[model samples]
Target: MQAKEAAEKLGITQRMLRHYENEGLIEIDRSENGYRRYSESDLRRAGRIRDFIATGFSTREIKSMSACLSDEGAGPCEGGVIKMQEKLEHIERLQADLDARKQAVLDRIEELKQGLAAEPLEL
Candidate 1:
């Protein structure tokens, strides 16, 4: 497949594909005429790399994952699983903190309502 075809299939820009190639995440064979040729496996790998990037994996982590992807029969790496778990846990903690802040704001609003009703302001 050509770069344009693969980019269309993956819904990513051609520049992004080239960037991935430059980073050694994906490789393309070159024709004798110098046109880049991508294989089916290369296309698949590009899709996975894009998916990982969309999910917030850092470029370093994506590079680490590319190694695991190179293995023919290997499943997802333990390190990748651990990193995703860590990210999820961090998100959960953030949600909890946000919830606490929201509740505090609601409580403050209710307290203001009560205090305002008791003191009947003169405008």
Candidate 2:
């Protein structure tokens, strides 16, 4: 299929396909006229890349899972599981930090409210 058709099917833009190719996530073939031609395997790989990106996985992390990204219908990749666990841990830490920041902001707001309540209103 052509780049446009592939991008449409994948629900991504052609530029994103090019970005994936540039990121070395998937390889696209060139037709006789030098236009990009996407094979079934390429589209499948691109879909995986898109899904991983949506799930917050970086291109570098995806690159490390090249073995699992292969077309071969192998069983579950243990390395992929490990990577997911690591990502989960990272996300949890970020969530904790965000929670703390949110609490701090809420506390400041409460303090400001109390201070305002203590001040007398001037006509």
Candidate 3:
């Protein structure tokens, strides 16, 4: 498969596939004309990589997870655990900040509604 087909099958942009190649997460074979030829194994690896990225794992993290993924989700990759924990902590902090902003917006909306109710003009 070529870059376009691989990208379409994986539901990602070609640029992202190039980035993954540049980051050493996946590799592609070059044809005689230098076009990228993705193998079946490459596609499978790319799918796993995409899944990890969607779950908030960084490229570096995905690179380190090859062992864990190959092991069928068995334990023993301490680094993978540590990286996941860090991502989880970051997500928690982000959720807290978003929650605060949502509450502030709701409060402002309610204040505006009350002000409008108090100053109703004569029909």
Candidate 4:
């Protein structure tokens, strides 16, 4: 397949495909006319790359997961689970920080509401 068809099938833009290539995520062959040629393996790898990005994995992280990204059978790859756990832990920490901030904002709003109730409106 060509770049357009591959991009369409992957539900990503051609620019994203190029970006993935530039990121060294996948390698695409060039045709006689210098057009990009995507093989099934390439498309599968690109799809995995897209999935990893959607899950908030950076290209660097994905690069580190080369073992999991291979066309080999879908068995557990060493370090893949560790990487996912690390990402989950990172997200959990972020969620905790956001929760604390949200609680602070809510507490401030409640304090302001109480103050407004205690004060008489002066027009």
Per-candidate TM equals 0.70, 0.94, 0.74, 0.93
In terms of TM-score, which candidate is stronger, 1 or 4?
Answer: 4
Residue pair clashes in candidate 2: none
Per-candidate RMSD, Å: 3.2, 1.2, 3.1, 1.3
By lDDT, rank the candidates, best first.
4, 2, 3, 1
Off by over 4 Å in 4: none
The Cα RMSD of model 3 versus the native structure comes to: 3.1
Q: What local distance difference test score does each model get?
A: 0.81, 0.89, 0.84, 0.90
Candidate 1 weakest lDDT stretch, 10 residues? 65-74
- Per-residue alpha-carbon lDDT of candidate 2 for residues 1-123, written as tens digits (9 for 90 to 100): 999999999999999999988989888889999999999988888888888889889999999998767677234775988888898999999999999999999999999999999999999
Compose the digit string of candidate 1's lDDT tens values, residues 7-114.
999999999999998888877898888878888888777877887789777667788766555545146765767777876887789899999999999999999999
Task: Give the number of the best model, judged by lDDT.
Answer: 4
Candidate 3 per-residue lDDT over residues 1-123, each given as its tens digit: 999999999999999989999998877799999999988778877887888899988888788777654435445665777877888999999999999999999999999999999996999
Q: Kindly list the per-residue Cα lDDT of model 4 for residues 33-54, writing each as its tens digit.
A: 9999999998888988898899
Residue 5 displacement (Å), model 4 = 0.9
